[model samples]
Target: MFTSILVPVDGSEHARKALSVACQLARQEGSTLHLLHIPEELSHETTLVWGIGAIAIEASREERENAGKQVISRAAEAAREQGVTEVETVIGQGDPARTILSEAKRRGVDAIVMGSRGLSDLQGFVVGSVSHKVSHTAECTVITVR
Candidate 1:
């Protein structure tokens, strides 16, 4: 049972699925859910959660941060809706994989739950996906939802 679980929210469908899985685990274990969002410029246009609309690759830093806010807020609310009592939301900046690892360690979470793919699927395929990097290096359990 996870005493604390870190979930990286990117406003993707797979992220929503990962959140659902995290919520399920959190409910069963009475875990604290930490939802973290890292705003990064994408190489391609991407759709966000709750129909917030697509974010252009040329979107400015402020625009990306704005979308990140909406994402983290909505994700926290979703956790509450799923019956998770202890929910925390955070926004960080930097490389996705490293930042996620940093947050997990900072929060001392027992697990990191995230989507197998994010907004940069093509880029991920070219390089290694953020989930792949985190899963390979994280100090704790990592659950990647497809």
Candidate 2:
């Protein structure tokens, strides 16, 4: 029933599992797969205040972006191999849950497929989980691939 599926990846093994699941579903349903990677946010002023070395900070930022690109590329390749014709990649910054939800809304996705770390109810309620927050805030259906 899904037309467009959004999957959020954080370069973790769990996130990779979510990508695989999303690709398979998109293939089966002939849906578009949208893979999203959000880079950690850091501004120049904040970096300077934190006393981070300019060269080291720049390298770290570059590394994060490169990693994000790899994740997007891998997801795209998987979708293509599975015969999914429409695959999109997005990269943004900010809270993972908020970014994912906002992107899904912007794309008007039918469903979201993501990974969960299987936190206990208490821990999740206290510290919060991205999956939980996304499920609550998203306008569409949310599927957690734990």
Candidate 3:
């Protein structure tokens, strides 16, 4: 029954699975698929904790954002292959959960389909998962794929 579905990707396997599921659902419902990639900012704590140097962390951020673009491109192609013709991709910046929620509201999406987990499993356990936060705070329906 959804007219528009938002799927956030982080290039994780879980996110890929969610993208596949969302594409199928969109095809079935004749809905548009909105693919969003949020490039998380590297925190000082993260660098220190992970033992990643500042220069390395800065380089990684750019690489990660580039990878995010590739992820969205692949996701859009997958959606099209699934017969969901209307697909849009966006690259967001900021906290993952807030970016996802804001995009959903801004786009007026009917539902959000996302992964149960992302690349930051340890961080998620410590600060709570993005999917968990979105599920609780989003105005629209949320489907978290495992």
Candidate 4:
């Protein structure tokens, strides 16, 4: 049985589903849920090209970190709403897969439940999905929710 579960979120619907599943499992197993959010950096050119019609960008590292914090807070709230009171939030920088794996190892989590797709699905296909990397590399069990 899992005693500690890690759930990485990126403000995506898939992540929300994964969080819901993780919450349910944690509640059933009396496990602690760890919610992780990694703030991504987008280049100016990329932002201009892809973010033209998007909402206003927060052009600062502190703003990005604050946004990440808000994301994790909402995720933790969702978990608590699911009746999982024991929740921890983590904000990490760098590669999503590596950060998640390191956090899992650091926290000694028994399992990881995350989304199959994130905010960078296209880039992930060209490179590799974080879920794919973590599933292959993590020492604990990985459940990728679609």
lDDT agreement with native, every candidate: 0.94, 0.73, 0.82, 0.83
Candidate no. 1 TM-score: 0.97
For candidate 1, write residues 28-79 as lDDT tens digits: 9999999999998888898898667889989999999999999999999999
What is candidate 2's lDDT per residue for 1-77, written digit by digit as tens?
A: 99899988655556767877888888788898888888653322111111222223345877667655765677677
- Pairs in clash, predicted candidate 4: none
Regions of model 3 farther than 4 Å from truth: 41-60
- Model 2, residue pairs in steric clash: none
Measured on C-alpha atoms, candidate 4 has an lDDT of: 0.83
Q: Which residue pairs show backbone clashes in model 1?
A: none
Instruction: Estimate, for each residue in 1-146, the C-alpha lDDT of model 4 and write its tens digit.
Output: 99999999877778889999998899899999999999776432122111122213445788667666777887888788889989999888899999999999999999999999876777788889989999999999999999
Ranking by lDDT: 1, 4, 3, 2
lDDT for each residue of candidate 3 in 18-134, tens digit (9 for 90 to 100): 988998888888898999988665432222111222223455777667666767787787778878899999999989999999999999999999999876777888899999999
TM-score of each: 0.97, 0.77, 0.86, 0.88
What value does the lDDT take at residue 66 in candidate 1? 94
Deviating ranges (above 4 Å) for candidate 4: 42-58
Q: lDDT score of model 1?
A: 0.94
- Runs of candidate 1 with Cα error greater than 4 angstroms are none
Q: Where is the poorest 10-residue window by lDDT in model 4?
A: 46-55
lDDT of 2: 0.73
